[model samples]
Target: MMASAGDMDTGSVLLAEKVTALSDPAAYPEFTAAVTAVETHFSWVFLTDGFAYKLKKPLRTEDMDFTSLAGRTRNCEREVYLNRRLAPDVYLGVVDLMATEDGRLRLFGSGRVVDRLVRMRRLAEDDCLEIRLKRGLVASEDVARLARGLAGFLTSQPPLGPVSPVGLRHEINTSLLDLAVACDGCFEQAVRRVTARLLAFLEYRSDMPGRDRLVDGHGDLRPEHVFLGPPLRIIDCLEFSDALRRRDPVDELAALGMECERLGGAWIGPVLLEAYGKAAGVFPPAGLCAFYRGLRALVRARIAVRHLMEEPIRAPERWPRQAAEYLRLADRAAAELTVPSGRRPSSSAAL
Candidate 1:
């Protein structure tokens, strides 16, 4: 996806608008109750006392646009719609951040709307799955329970028919290419290993042809996005792209497995895989699981190293190490891509 000069100019203009209009805390007086504001990839999140406000950044990518109000509004609506499938209680709705005549921004008020934001109920921060992973407190029961719950969640949505083989290949290759370009410093060798495995898997699609119908699911079903129960809530689906969000259940479960293995909970990964197999009555192909898990690891590794691109001179102290760790996970998972190189296994044994 090479960018044209016009595309570059358009992206720059949109980025400038976001930085100028949405970045200032002082601009949004209606958010006076906000405890803090956090920046995500393409949105700004304001954490109020009981609610969270996520404002789109009006940014542009080759495949996505958050620049126009109509575009943002539709995406905002889609965000609520898709996320409600998993966390109905959490994604409250969408609200307009209108610009008042007096030049101040008011949220959910009558005026000319400047930007659209997805409003959500804030989950318990301390109880996020990351904290549990960090403390080594995740019980086998918890993993099993999450697996069962996730299986139900994945199966709840009606299948959208088999995902296109070509589209699936594009999805994996695009991310892998970007990763190779983004984390070349510490990632070159390991990335080559993972890329080779993914390429091999891509070639042998008949063996792991993703037979399941795609679900509109949590595209980024990571530990950090999950909350441990009393009531389990997974917030922040990839609202920006439907192609990225649509996935087979096995692929989605494998993503969680990848993250678990990354964060020192290696035992938890196999438990999740086993749970999914038992609950869903689907023995996901070994190579398919390994490919999905490795691809996800490489994706996370790319994200971690993007800070170098953003602030090469003074990126965070921890990112290089984090990137290296992710790359190692990528290599390990890729190397574990079992079954013969070009042989096609029975695509579904448990189904």
Candidate 2:
């Protein structure tokens, strides 16, 4: 039976109550000094002294759906299972948010299940690679260690299938349209040229390099999701779509390199490539790396600009600058596709 409008209102109030309760330190099983609620695009993370609990919003987007209880539960389970690949110790388990007989909500309460949350051991903020990079605390050795770890992990994965150049082109076209709408057409021509050059590079090779090496990998590989340790921990694999998560190892590495350069660690990019090459036993072509990096940069720029499309836009002042910066990086990387003999461009090319 379809829920009446009044019933939906009641459900919303219940959700709000649950969220408010989760934000309270008293709702936790142990004594928490405080609870800090951090909101992201898809979920709410309630941070405590030693743990973080992620609750998915009952929302649907183009790529994901968490609008039903069953869907959210399934995603919660998937989040823990997939993240365990790289951060086994961090993703603890999933817990239910329940409503009490007295119409109160609480975590793990013995009553009707109202929602689900993914529980995790909170990582140190200072140990995050992004934070370390920003503080100028990341060293070449750190990058080397990360590269070795990532290379071993990536090489061990079984190949899912081959990448389709036509499919990728379609994705690029969709993102270009998205960018045009998001940035008021400011970057339409520039991005079109960059994407066209990328297609040319692929066509010139006849066979797309590394197309058959796509694996179910960590989809989001920014430094922010990487923890720097003697034993590194990476979290937040894109848990929604298997297709999106399947990617060439080089493409993933190139995306990470692009992010490192964006974070003011240009030296880190080259060091990562060298170490990963030695570990993986095959150096990726410099031209292909450049192409992947540029492609990722354009995607990232679109993502940054798309924040404006969200209701109650987050950091309204920041997205434009971020999008412009990524566009700059994309342009620089696209230019490298034209270098003769696949000669690697200098890492110190000014951003």
Q: What C-alpha lDDT, on a 0 to 100 scale, does residue 245 get in candidate 2?
A: 89
In candidate 2 the C-alpha lDDT for residue 225 amounts to: 96
- Alpha-carbon local distance difference test for all models: 0.72, 0.82
* Candidate 2 per-residue C-alpha lDDT over 47-100 given as tens digits, one digit per residue, 9 for 90 to 100: 999999998877776677777778889999999999999999999999988777
- Give stretches of model 1 more than 4 Å off: 1-34, 163-165, 171-176, 179-186, 204-206, 303-320, 339-351
Q: Which regions of candidate 2 fall more than 4 Å away from where they truly are? A: 1-15, 339-351
Candidate 1 lDDT trough over 10 residues, lowest sum: 1-10
* Clash-forming residue pairs, model 1: none
Least lDDT summed over 10 consecutive residues: which range in candidate 2?
1-10
Candidate 1 is scored at a TM of 0.81
